[model samples]
Target: MIPGYPKETFFVPDGIYLLSHSVGCLPVSTEKHLSDSFFRPWANSGGHAWTNWLDNINAFTQALAQLFNSNAQNFCPQVNLSSALTKILFSLPTPTHRNKVVFSARDFPSIGTVLQKYCKTLELEPVMIPQDRNLADPQTWSDFLDEEVSIALITHVVSNTGQKLPIRDIVQLCRDRTITSIVDIAQSAGIIPVDLSHWQADFVIGSCVKWLCGGPGAGYLWVSDNNIHECQPDDIGWFSHKDPMSLTMNNFEYAPDARRFTGGTPSVIPFTLATESIKLMHSAGIEHIHSHNKKLLSRLASQLNVNSPCQPNERGGTFVVSFSNNQKALQTLTSAGVHCDLRSEGLRLSPHLYNSASDIDTLAELINPLLGKRR
Candidate 1:
């Protein structure tokens, strides 16, 4: 592997932390920005500090826009992907014929939970595509779409198995069937190229707490150029009004772009915290980080005992390694200061740019003896 990034760049855990798919390691600059940009302003300026916070909000949106090769106007901040998806679900008209929302049962449970409410209240159908298909192939989804499907919620990278659905093809198919495609980019946001504006999918949700290293409380929603103008989400607050400052009790209008999706007062601290992490990501280009992490996963896989694991290119930031006694195995890794999480498939390992080959090799050495045998 290339000379890896400095560990000093992050406030890493005591052991080898491999849980970027869950919550990313803290970046060193987080402290400085939180103080200088957020705490400092509020402490010094009292109630009038909102002007500075608003600027941070704009900056945060702009920073995220750079990742997807879009502008600030294309994105809006939300509390989380669930809320972002909820706004969209409430916004879209309940179709007369095409009322099914297609998604995989194995996708994130929270998303399914959100969709289920729509199914109950809005008379939408839940079309859970069978999980029996080849775990690594997007072609399995080719037949899942039809005119009856109104919205397709696709997980860009499956949380458990690190499998990536062919989003581009899926979006294209949605277009053919006239279905709205809403993508969840939680596990792949910073590590992989989402390029939401390029794909022109109906909507996408990304969080700053995971791979983006921005911590929690900052969620992103990106509306495609094709759907931005006409999108009128039912979730409304005066902040998202076409003109927030100009208010009319009789007449209310939503913002022209992604801003229409955002409602209510936001926690402004996330913007300040995320700025530093985004800067670090830009400094270490995402493509380069992806290439390095992929090679590391392939290297780790070469040291594992498994059958036909998805290739590096086929997956995103996580790789699940199975064990007969995963609990004991987890305890062992934790004891050795190697951090990972257990999921449906196996124990998940997610490395970031800050993780080096030596770290993976060390983790593998700790993990090898725990394989197959429960004791």
Candidate 2:
């Protein structure tokens, strides 16, 4: 029953945009915000624009802090999630005894790839939970976090399957075992209510391009205050210095907070664009948007054979449903102006605040006949 969502605030595609799980619809104010915050400063001040541009990045972190219910000082902007993970993996001291780095097979392939490639050099064994194992079960993770496990990468939500994990419980399990936990919130951040304080994970990483409606290159990392000092990022630069303006080439000290993860000159324009979209999401309230999305998903679920978790709380904003002929169904849905994407698991249909019940009805009507039809 949440109302007053300003759908006009975003520039939705001509067809139904159920692809927010991939790339979010652009915010209508993105251009103006970019112009005012980024382009104008560069145009007006040229070399002197660093002050405003840096302020825009700070504003981006501030908006993220508010959204996730945590301190702004705990966040450091990165180019993307993969880079953030790389920084974290390289920063942590190689374990003396615990040599295993654990992740789920269901996790986004990029994460597994990063772990596989890096663990070899780091002398850590990359252990993946088998694809058949239930990732949503806390026991499944507890069994995997043996004494040999030093680090665990927990995806807050499975991208392809729309399965939401019990991150808090899993993080607690890791904490009990003295295993460092890195929670990936890329799929869950904008749509789900994320309270970093509650999870208290050692580290959390995500990108703004997906559901945040922020353009690419605005990824961020959040390190716990308890664990921040212990991290010594191998990827340090002037930006990671205690004082970025110190100009002391010989005496470089890491910034005492999460800024230690920042490397070199930060990308300013992406943060500028992200700050605007984040502010827009804040204006609408995440809880309200979550409620609206669930309602639409529920309506759609009633008509479709959803492959995602049956319970609303067990899934993210996106829902996965199977089709007899994946290509044909995708083509039919596209032809009918119902935009969505096919993952290896199934077709993913994501509904945002801009989508309505009628949109779901349209999707159902078109998809019902294509459910089990032969090609």
Q: Highest TM-score: give the candidate number.
A: 2
Native-referenced Cα lDDT, model 1: 0.82
Evaluated at residue 17, the lDDT of candidate 1 is 84
Q: Write the per-residue lDDT of candidate 2 for residues 1-375, one digit (tens) a residue.
A: 236556787899887889999889899989998999899989999989999999998999999999998999999999888889988988988798998999999888888899888899877799999988888889999899999999999999899889889999999999999999999999987888899999999999998898889989999999999989989999999999999899486999999999999879988989999999888888788888888889898888788754464357788889887776888888989998888999987889999878878888988888778875744
Candidate 1 Cα errors over 4 Å, as ranges:
1-5, 307-309, 372-375
lDDT per residue for candidate 1 within 187-299, as digits (tens), equals 88888876765677888988989888999988988888777866778877878888887857866888888888767777788777887788778667789888888888888
What TM-score do all the candidates reach, one by one? 0.95, 0.97
**Candidate 1 least-lDDT 10 residues:** 304-313
Q: Tell me the number of clashing residue pairs for each predicted model.
A: 0, 0
Error of 1 at 338 (Å): 1.0
